[model samples]
Target: MSARRIDRRGFLKTAATLAAPIIIPASALGLGRKIPSERITIGVIGLGGRGTQVLKDLLKLPDAQVIALCDVHPEHHREFENGKGPRLGSTPARELVDKAEQARSGQPGKPCFVTGDHRELIDRPDLDAVLVATPDHWHAAITLDALRSGKDVYCEKPVTHLFAEGQAVYREVAARKAVFQTGSQQRSDALFQQAAEIVRNGHLGKIRSIEVGLPPGYDKPMGSTEVKTPPAGLDYDRWCGPSPKLPYMNARHHRWWRGQRAYGGGVLMDWIGHHNDIAHWAIGEELGGPTRVESVGWTTPDVDIYDTPVDYEIACEYAGGITSRISTKVTEGTKWIGENGWLWVTRGKIKCSNAALLDKSFDRGEWVAGPTGSHVANFLNCVRSRAACIAPAEQAHRSITPGHLGYVSFSLKRPLRWDAKSESVIDDSDADQLLKKSESRAPWA
Candidate 1:
């Protein structure tokens, strides 16, 4: 399709339709009642840092309600209650309780129930959907359960810890016929959309390569620490859901677990998911994985706490001779290298090689300004209409595969070819084994 003929206006019109008001009958909307209005009642499965952020965002939508909240730590429940609890009533244990009380009394508040066991949360008949924001290893399993229960899902980025699980997520979403949106919110950002449109329309002619910068991996040395008994209210086994059990350490417990290989994929999967998503969107490949990957750097040599590469470079090849180079150590920004000129974008600035590329201004007179407003608006609209979300599961799966494949290559320290068709490594035993999930510990297993 010609760039100008791509119909930005029509695309925006479709987005507007997807952002239409959600309508539900007052009776159907009653809390503690049947799952109301295909307008999804959402359960947040991991109420830590990222999950809490998602809960806050979902609260803004009029049609959606938080039916349940689940986390391993009791401290998180305390924080959510102390901070947002009293506003609802006296002491509602979960967000759902508050929501139900508000509905009964005809008051304005969020309705959500709380639980430490995510399995109970997923099994709730009141829930129409779930948001999975747990560690990398737990993402696939939780998502699968949510799907099996006939609920739509919004999972955090880097969707799967292993390449093999992507196909499972794909199959489950298709089989259940559910709406799955990946939390790669960049897809909902106007600036990112604009950037991708510019490249797609040949604003950057004959694109050569794209480079993305992620936060640097831990470059500091690991401090020595002794393993301690699991804390009183924290369900350590549940927290380690699909990952192997190890002695308790402060760094691997909460948010810092992103630095570990067992629970995270390091900076590559951690940060690259955003830009790689944009890169794939700009290139217009519907469903393609990287053909080859190689990496040759390390962020830290610490073998004690974390095992992911700290600093590394990876090259991914696609059809039509296009290549994307992602690095962990670059200054945080995204650069597009093309035959005609280049464009660089970060949160603070956007620059083009010719400087003329910046001269063109998008006619946003009719468009929304920020990402949070635009993206959330889109999802709510789709919930009512049963349309596709802007960042659907299939697209997210394709975008994230590059970073996961890159990690696999770096860990194996060899060139690996991937069959995007089969979502597997070609022929190499070690790489093939890394493609699937590693078994978690017992009990939680």
Candidate 2:
């Protein structure tokens, strides 16, 4: 509650236990048909590109108020209004605080708490939920911490950087009964929902195969070999969080970290959580995944900047003889082929083998793939109503597993047989070793 910036000293104390009960402070609960004063108080962690975009979307909602923000990069919190810093063509975190103030009917807004440590934000009993748009590696740790601290979470996807961390996140969400919305916003798109309905309604009978396309990797390798002084105001050490504290490079510091194996899984992990999730939804396998995975990929020629695969093909065989082929070769949407017909859907377009399938109407209460509102709006509604979100944490975990398996199989250069229930690989000790959850680096571990 103090106005002082949170000091990072001793912040990496043992992670709060995951077994805590759902401790919703009284103000957040029992407000049936509540008024605007009962608006949801949100805290945002990570204020990079995606974080800023999501924050803007949240700002549009009158019932949600962003009360605090935390980012390791202090430049993000720079006051753009004063025009006093190195200007990047990016939105500063302070804009959200200003907007939050305007939303408060011209009265002075509560001070927007800023911190480099997310733990301080999550531990606040006053905060209702936190939007976690941190890097992929930090996703599991931060989301788990928030849920264990009794806050609902809207975690950006691929919900887990490593495959094994999915189950732990899923388990904690279930145990705490906290609403978690994965930031796979495609689940809320109408075209995607229509395609999922066609598939679910048996309009695409006995799915033969689904082809998923994701964004291609960097034509040139990403990241920098140069080690320089950490930028002023940026706590590069805390930014590295659970991953190896590699030397600071501008390329890997902010947005470009997506192309690195340490912080992300290249384009495959970056886009798979969106497109591959649709593939799983259409195949009626949102809760489980393929039994086997095999992949081959090319690591960039120059390892100085990027080491993640530059190109790859992955094939997964699911139960009931369903097959999914995910690669950089196909188009950006999912194409579901089946005995009766096929439906292909993407952000703004939907095409089907039977033209009528595109116009088919569903009966009331029929199963639909998405929520009726924007992804962020749905998370806020669920935060209030205690309803399950469309992109629940468990489904996001299952949806993203193929991407993880693909990366691991490509790195190991071997096929892997997965036991989805056990969340392990079958009979391959080498691949099995890769399935273990990542141990947080020292002090945080």
The top-ranked prediction according to lDDT is 2
- Candidate that scores best on TM-score: 2
- The positional error of residue 314 in candidate 1, measured at the CA in angstroms, is 0.9
Estimate the lDDT of model 2.
0.77
lDDT of 1 by residue, 113-205 (tens): 677777899999878788898888888888988888877788888877766777789788776666677888887775676677667767778
- Consecutive 10-residue window with the lowest summed lDDT within model 2: 11-20
Question: For candidate 1, which ten residues in a row score worst on lDDT?
Answer: 363-372
- Provide TM-scores for the models: 0.84, 0.86
Cα miss at 211, model 2 (Å)? 0.3
Report the CA-based lDDT of candidate 1 relative to the real structure: 0.69
The segments of candidate 1 whose C-alpha lies over 4 angstroms from its true place after superposition are 1-6, 22-39, 76-111, 221-224, 359-372, 443-445
RMSD of model 2 against the true structure: 10.6
Q: lDDT tens string, model 2, 3-116? A: 442322222121112111233444564423222236788999988768888988988777778888888875642332225544321235666567667666787675678888
